[model samples]
Target: MRIRTRLLLLSLAVLLPAIVAAALGIGFVYAEERGINQRNLQETSRAMALAVDRELGTREILLKALASAPSLARGDLATFHEHARVIAEEREASILLSDENGRVLLNSRLPVGTALPALLPTAVQERRDAGPDVTIVSNLYRLPRNPDVPPSFALQVPVPHTARPHLYLAMTTPASQLQALFEQQRLPSDWHATIVDRQGVVVARSSDPAKFVGTHVRPELQDSMAAGEGMHPGMTLAGVASTAFFSRVPRSNWSFLVSVPDAELRRTGLWASALLGGMSLLLLALATLAALAVARRTAQPMEDLRHDAQQLGDGAPVQARSSGLLEVDAVNEALVGASERLRRASADLEHRVAEAVASFEQSQRALLQAQKLEALGRLTGGIAHDFNNVLQTLTTGLHAARLGSDDKVRRLLATCERAVTRGSELARQLMVFGRVQEVRVETFDLAQRLREVQPLLTGALPTDITFTQDVTPGLWPVTADPLQLELALLNLVMNARDAMPHGGRLRLRAGNSVGQSPAQDLPPGDYVAISLQDEGEGMNEEVLARALDPFFTTKSVGRGSGLGLPQAYGFARQSGGALVLRSQVGEGTTVTLVLPRAQVAPQEPAPAAPSGGLRGAGCVLLVEDDPLVRDTVRSGLEVSGFEVQTANDADEALRMLAGGHCVDVVLTDVVMPGSMNGVDLARLLAREHPRLRVVIATGYSDRSIDMPGVRTLAKPYALHQAVAALNEAMAG
Candidate 1:
């Protein structure tokens, strides 16, 4: 998943439970608070009911005592009235009495016979309303002359004296005392106790009496008064919701109502829940944010790793970043290390690949050389088969003409012979091209040889150009194929000449090279470096690198043969040397031929010899594959006064040898068209003709041959060359 999505999921995973728990926890706290509020309200209601019951019990006892007193019926002015007055004073009440006509006869605080209109009317009304012998309680009314005082209750006791249900007397307990009882009642903060008459009128309230007392008691209060028991119920006064409980005083027919606002009971719980929930939400939100931050920090390392991996995959270098968290830091460190290793490994791989390509190219070059050599061998064999016959004919014809010679005809024959010689030279050049030439290794001073060729090089160049030879003195001699080395130098010098067509200076130089350094791939050793340089129009780097590639020529048309540099390169490698090239498009080029230096013996002065060279004293065996060639050679020997025995092939020569022909030399064709060539024939006669000197002559060469103690002569040779070769063979 993507980073944003993953972070979101992680945040949710961590935060989900917190939010849920906070909500549930808040709910639980609210419920607990609500329960506590309810319990407190219930306790306050009971407290309020007890307080009301005590106050009502005192009022009812005061009312009963007044009703039984005989003076309480008469008046406060009579003996009974004085007694009643004393009783009222003791009870802290107001009292009055009435006659049979329902006129007030005595007033507890009045003079001897006072008619109080409110009191007399209240008494008469209670007398008229009373049944026989029944005590009745009256509603509160204002006394006639005492309107300032609140209406007091009429308690009528009908005596068996007069017709109007006897005289009725009534008394009132102090309303202030009744109200003080309710007001002092203990209740919860939101609860209040109130007293109500049996008619459901509000009388005394624990709250503000002026406002609440005149207000009708709640329906639950009325029910409590009617049932004479307590009841708890909910009420709405105006819009405020409250819980009301009521209980009545049993004897007094008064009610106690405790009203607790539901809002009050729930306020603490609601506020607590609000405060807790708000805090929890804030805390949870912060926690969620923190969790997201932590997750992102942890994931940072992975993100960097992924990005770096992508870069590497796209072939860029790997990169890493740092994070502060420990695990993230460790992961980042690992990734950083991995990236570095990958970079190193990748660089190593690229280098190895380059080396592998170079190795493959070398193998391909070797394979191509092998294939070319095989093909050349076949071609050479075919050509030699044809040319041998032609040579035999020309050689024989020349012999016959010289025997019957006119000087001009002989000269003409010499010209023909020259043509044959030139053709033979061409054939040899081709053989060398096929790498089929026999090589003889001998120690020679390469530097001296180069010095000798310097003057010749100067003569060959134009006058405007100068040849400078920096031949290091005392340079070591080297063993090499001298002829091929000379050819390679010629090709390089000619290439240099073409580069500097404007006649620039050329340098032929040799020195030791520190190879396999960054500057060169040659090892540190003694080297014979023959450098040919010119202020020439040089090649670019692309061309320089591919300069030795076969058939790659920048020269136009026949102006150059591409084989020059390639041949030089091949020859150098075959001779255990290296050819390094350098050039820039504007600057000149340097072709350095590096060969391992060799040691040589110091030269000794020689004296002149006798006119004729030494000759062994034995008959010479001539093994010639061609009859005409063999006869011609035999005649030359006879003329030279040397004894000779001849055969057309190795087998015949062997038979003649077995027949005891005494030979000082075995002269034979090296590439005879027979079961055995001259080299094999020489081997056969080697022991028998131990004193024999073997000389080989051929028009072709097989590069595979490694015969020793042999001197090779080209076909169509003059008499002098044959004599010279024979002497050299004997000398060796």
Candidate 2:
């Protein structure tokens, strides 16, 4: 086949399916538009129904108030009639007093001596009989003597009378009052709204109130309403076709209907379909013409290119010419230059191949380094858990020994306690670096915290490298783990000191800032930016790019673990902020930690700890994986006046509990070697023995426990702290 003919056929193949899809999309849009319209109409109908019910409810309240009139209870019909008339005038309604048999004893719309006809509807009487205090709403009804008045409904409440308990007070509200509600809706002119009673008789019509009031709705609509509330197709009273939505008013059998003419609903869909079909046909015609034109213009050029390709393959020289198309012309020019370029390309290929091999080797080394770093992080976390256990054992043993020592021996024990505390801090930092510990966030003044840690920050730097602090006045408070923030600052100061081996001025500056650094990607909010600037040997771009990467360091191997900057970065990010670094080779490096400002005032400092050790009387179940820590803790608890039982792990604890070995409180280590951990055991006890208190003691845990009846005591705590934790848990 000719090229033009083939191209035209291809165009038809592609265009035909697109045209079909366009038609399907148009059909779906039409259906969806119809659904949206129906839903809107349903919502409007429901809102109007609620309005009707509220209007009726208001009138019912008025009737109940009238029924409790002192004059009515005293049988002073004249005085009661006067009061009812005044209320009726104020509410634009008519009040009537009726007997249980539906006889009107007094009518607010008539004189007191005038004889009144039976005005109570049977629905109201039946509803009243169902419950004496129940408010009843009757269907559209007419007063026998007032036939000229508009259609109205009755709201009645049974009178609470000592002697005449059967009496009822009623309020007659005209259907025209509902017309005001419809007007408030401000529906489109073509739409119609109506309120109908249980019998499907129109109580109020939005379009023609006088003509349709008290008239029965169409049989089709009546059937739709009988089926329940929803959208249906029907004709308006004027014989115009419409899509109708109906919803029943709450607390009554009456329903409200909203209708839009079918012409209005289908107009948009019909026009869209016609317009889309016309556009699709025009597009197909234009595409076919373009395809034929393109094929004609490129056919000779394609032939020439094929001949040149054959020549090049045979190592023969080939001529080039313009082919009108840019792409085709480029291919022709390439053919003319192919012979000379192929010789040069062969030499360049070897060089490119060597570079590719070098790049691949570099990438392999990087991948290996990354894997090693990841393994190290996991190993660090595991080692930290055991390290905490050892620290706890030493802490508990020292406290137990110091309980009866003299002042000289107690002073030595206090020094040992300080060493244990330092060890615990080291273990916690390892857990934080490994990303296994949760941040304990609290609100605190950043400026105050910086001042408190200034001594430590200054002491870490060399005397030659002067340290200075600049804090903005009235610094906004920030929320974060205060202890972690202090550690991060210390790490930054150390890094600054390392950067300036020759000793240069170092400054720590803090101030309030908005999210001004686009590179940091901090969220747009108020933040406290604390930056440490050093006049040291700054890093180049390559080194700075990987500065926050774990285990990526430039210092000598033994001098740095490459975790300081990364840990600070992790802390900033985990606290809902960002770490930003600015550095150059010669000038200096400035590292900034942007922390989110606290939304509330800083909490007041906690009260001082009690002076003496806490003593409690109870059988305590101790669960620990470390035998030395368990024995030490049990001895300490025994000295505090408690019977202690020891278990190796969570499984043994559960077994002991299952065997009915009663204990008032369970003190378990969070990180334990068993099928379950301390958190799991605490949750099980919470479910099975809700009254039992649980105290979870741990140096560090990857998981957090926030359960009732559970208290957490940090590792390396003194004996007094453990006893206090137990006492608090038991009391709680």
Candidate 3:
């Protein structure tokens, strides 16, 4: 076929399908737009409903606060009435006090000595009496004495009194107060919003609220209101057709409805489709004309280009010639330079290929190193878990044995307990290195914490190396896991000590920092920078670059695991800070930890320790997968004046509970070999036996238990500490 004929046919084929696609897309766009409008309606309804509920909640809070006044509690009605009147005026609501017989004792809206009617609704009284002490919201009603006023509702809170058990404190809020909630939404002028109580009586409206207040919704919306929340085609109370969306208010039976006129919705879709279709048709016509012009202009130029390509492929030099068209003329000029460019490209191909291979090999080596480090972290995490369990067993056994031992034997047991504590610390370090440790952040004075750890830091260094400390007088408090911070500091100090084999001075300094550190890519913020500087042979550029990389070290294999600096770096970053290192080959090395400053002040000192005595007495169910830990914990609890039941795992614990093995508290391990872990077991117990207390014990730092009202005891806890936790849980 001729090129012009082909181009004309191609344009027809493409344009025909495009027109059909545009037609189809109009339907999709219409549906999408309609869905977006529906979602907007629903969201607006929800927002308005939330606002209404928030207003009601505020009134209920005020009434409850007023009910607790000392004047009311002491039967001083004159003083209480004065206070209630002030509060009612401030809140723009009326406060009423009623006796058990539904007779008003005091009404903030009326004079103190005026005779009041028994105005409490029967439903409000019955609901409050049937359920626990709670706030009850009455349906819309008019005051019996003042029927001319707007419709209102009451928020009733029961007051605990010695003589009058059913004394009620009620706040009367005009339904019009809810109209403000609708106005806050700023809905389109064409849109309408309504709020209806449980019985479908209109309490408030965004449009003509005064006319519609206290009126029942139209029959067309009765079924939608029954469904609680949904979208449906309906008519507004004024008889205007609309697409309405309704959402039920939280903590109440009321519903909020938002509606847009059907005419407006349909008009919007029609206008968008009409405009889109018009634009598409115009573009299609222009494209057809452009295609025809191009086909006529390029047909001869394409022939010339084909001949030039054949000459170049046959290794013959071709003479350049212009073809009038700019693109064809450019192609002719390119043929003149093609031979030289190809020659140069071929000459440099080998060098480029070698460089690409070198880059790929380096990437492959780095990837392999990353994979090895990842596998090492997983192995380390598992080892840490089992090691902590062993330490817990040892610690528990030492505590259990020291109870009745003589002075000498008790002293020996104390030494063993210290060793167990050290082992636990080592396990925690492994977990930290594996990035599996849970950090409990708290605000603490860094200088005070450093002073507390001075003994440990000084003990870790050799006597030949002198240690010096210089802390800023008013250092900023920082937020971090205090234990982790201590561990990081100890690791840095140890690294400094190792660097100075020969006697050298090591200085520790802490001060506040601000702004950015470009070298570390530190963000601009307030920080507490703690630096450890040493006078020793420092790291070279290459060593410094990989200093924080996991398992990269210069020390002998048995001497170091190479996780010290890396762990410190991870801790700093996790605490929203950065670690910075500045070093040279000969001039000493300085490692600085730039920790974000705490926004809150440091907490007060903890209370004094409880007396050293076992103070628990309850039946305890002990669940543990490890036999040694289970036995040690059981013996300790039994010695603390408790009857103990044993279960190997969650499944066994469930069976024991099902078989009517009564226990006051269930102390279980979090991670176990079972269908359910300790957290799951605790939740199940909570649902099935809510009155029972639960205490979870786990050595794995990464497990986060979010069960409120349940106690958690870290593994390797002393007998007294476990007893204290159990006691607290039971009391709670």
Candidate 4:
């Protein structure tokens, strides 16, 4: 072999690789360009679809508004036709009003007295016949005035009150409006766009719409799009091979298409590649001289920009300096802007974190307060149950003494009885705070009920304080226990009186709320708000936080029981309502009850009852769990001239009955420790001794009990009340 042949072989090795590399690079560039063009066509199709959907939605809203016009409801066809004409001309559309049988009564494009025509197609008429209230939207169809006129579609809505049944108000818009929407998207000039309804009918076309509108789309395109929105490569309606993308319009049974011709894209890509090949030799000559200078100029600035970006990521400030080159200067400027934004962002993030922490602390405090209130409520309920038993003994013993004592002794006994009555009221307040008190719900006008209690409220206030009322005249009726509402009102009024030590104004206001505000917790509906506003020393946030807790009072020790606010809160919640309190130090306080409204008819008022009480004449058997209560009640009944037998519990009472004791009535407590409580005992007696009378009495009774054909006596009852219950049971 020759030395020259060996050198030629090495040169061929380097040149062949360079030639192959250039060919591969050109192919990669063409593939990337094709992908970019495909994505751009898809995005353009989706944008056009969205724009057309918005246009149709605005038209639908307009049709619905015209359906609610007063002129149409009043049977004034002339006025309604004129009004529809003005609206149609302003929006560049046609309007029609039709009767139940689909006969056109008025068309905005023609004179009002023109002979009527059938305005709806067969498909639309079938839907209306099935359900007259249905909204009917039509596909594109030819205009009736002339075949040369543009195609149009109709939007129809039911007119609720018109001269004819199943009347409709329809608005017809030309296909030109949606074609204009497609054109407004500023898509590439060579791209073709069309809007089609669900039935494959072409409603609008960007190119030559006069020929394509109201025509069915080609069978090939319809079959491809039937599966859903997507892209495909196929021949277009005009017999040109193109890449087409389709998308569905939101909230409508319509779709849009964007098509780009493959021939046009291929021509552009070929021309670009040819120009690049021609410029390669010229660029090679210049590159040798520019590379050294370009590298020297850009190295420092590029490095500086990179280092500053890292600092910005670390939450530190950066200052960027520019290189003289155009591209490098652009990068430097972006870095500087980014660094400044980073500083501002860091400060904003710190501020947001601080606010979040403060909110979390406030929520934690509120949760703790609620838990404390719940625990206190449970404890208070237990104490109240035991306290009522003691009061029952005192009440019955005092009533017995008052009946048999001399003049002076009777006066002393009356004082004891009054004290016992006040104690019983206190126990009742505890039950209310625990949310265990039963209520008898009824529907009544809240405004009228407030007026009935106005006199009592005014008399309870101090002499130095003036009272004012601002009740809305025709407020909605509310469903609640009337007795509980009156007691809650009295409690609020008394609290207001105590707040103003010297003198202040107290106002009671009632109003209706539509529950539109987002800050309210009530469901979306109507409510009645009753507010008690007082001008006195208000509470601080810490005091307000625990204001609703049981036995939580700001007053001096012996001056308050702290049950007033809790009772009001409990009652409101138990009645499907809410209580809201707003107070500020050195300002005033306002407490409002948001009670739900009810739909109930008014009933005639009943006559008031007489004052005299009933008498007793039966042999009574008294059964109670507590010994003190049993003995005191039994002694009272014996003194009242009724034969009395006593038992400590239901089991003992059942034993006495099993022994064949003679008794006219059996009185038992509803809650006991044994397996058979008072309600169970009564059920047994009804079955075993069918003719024996029964009376259920309890200081704290469970509301779940079902006592049929028996009288009930609420305790802390006086001797006279017990005797009355006995007589009532005997008579029944």
- Model 1: residues >4 Å from true position, as ranges? 1-43, 46-50, 63-77, 90-92, 98-103, 118-147, 151-164, 186-191, 217-241, 271-290, 301-732
lDDT of 2 at 573: 88
Tell me the lDDT of candidate 1. 0.64
Tens digit per residue, CA lDDT, model 4, 1-732: 433344444444545565566657666766677777777777878888888777877887888898888988887778888889999999888888877777788888787789967764653565565477766667777756678867777777788765545687788877787767765677667788989887899998888787877788777788777766788788777778987789887645678998888976666556666566556534544553454345445366656667877887887777666567787678767877888888888899999999996885565555544643643543454355456776787778777765553643354354455445545555554454345667778888788888756644654565677888999878988889866887788678878988999989999999988854312667777788899999999999999999998767777633456777987888888888899999999898999988887878545456333210334666888999866677767767876788989888889888998998899999898766566889889999999888998988866655655567788888778889889888878888
Per-residue lDDT tens digits for candidate 1, residues 1-732, read 766567777777777887788788888988999777666655655565566556555544565565566543443336766667787788677666655466666677776756565445645555555554555555444556656776455455544344553555556665546666654543454566666766777666666766655566656546555765544556634435676655555445565666778677678888988998889878877877787687777676667767766776666665555656676567656656776778778888999999987875565555555544543443455456436534654654454444433653454355446446545654654554455677756667777667644533443455566777887767767778766776677667767877887888888878765434212555666666777877789998788878998766677543454667998888778767788788887678888887776656534325323111212334667888655466666655554446878888888877877787776677788756457877787676565566667887776645444567667767656555666677677667
Ten consecutive residues with minimal summed lDDT in candidate 2? 605-614
Q: Which candidate is the best by TM-score?
A: 2
Q: Candidate 3, residues 351-422: lDDT per residue as tens digits?
A: 899998688556555554464365354345445555667677767666666563364345435444544555
Of 2 and 4, the candidate ranking higher by lDDT: 2
| lDDT of candidates 1 onward, in order | 0.64, 0.79, 0.79, 0.75
Model 2 per-residue lDDT tens digits across residues 52-108:
888778777777787888998888999999999999998788888877667878989
lDDT of 4 at 34: 72
Clashes of 4: 0
Each model's TM-score? 0.35, 0.38, 0.37, 0.35
- The CA-based lDDT of model 4 is what? 0.75
Listed per candidate, the RMSD to the true structure in angstroms reads 41.9, 26.2, 32.0, 31.9
- After TM-score superposition, the amount by which residue 329's alpha carbon in candidate 3 deviates from its true location, in angstroms, is 43
TM-score of 1: 0.35
Q: Can you tell me which runs of candidate 4 are displaced by over 4 Å? A: 1-10, 99-101, 110-114, 123-136, 143-148, 160-164, 266-732
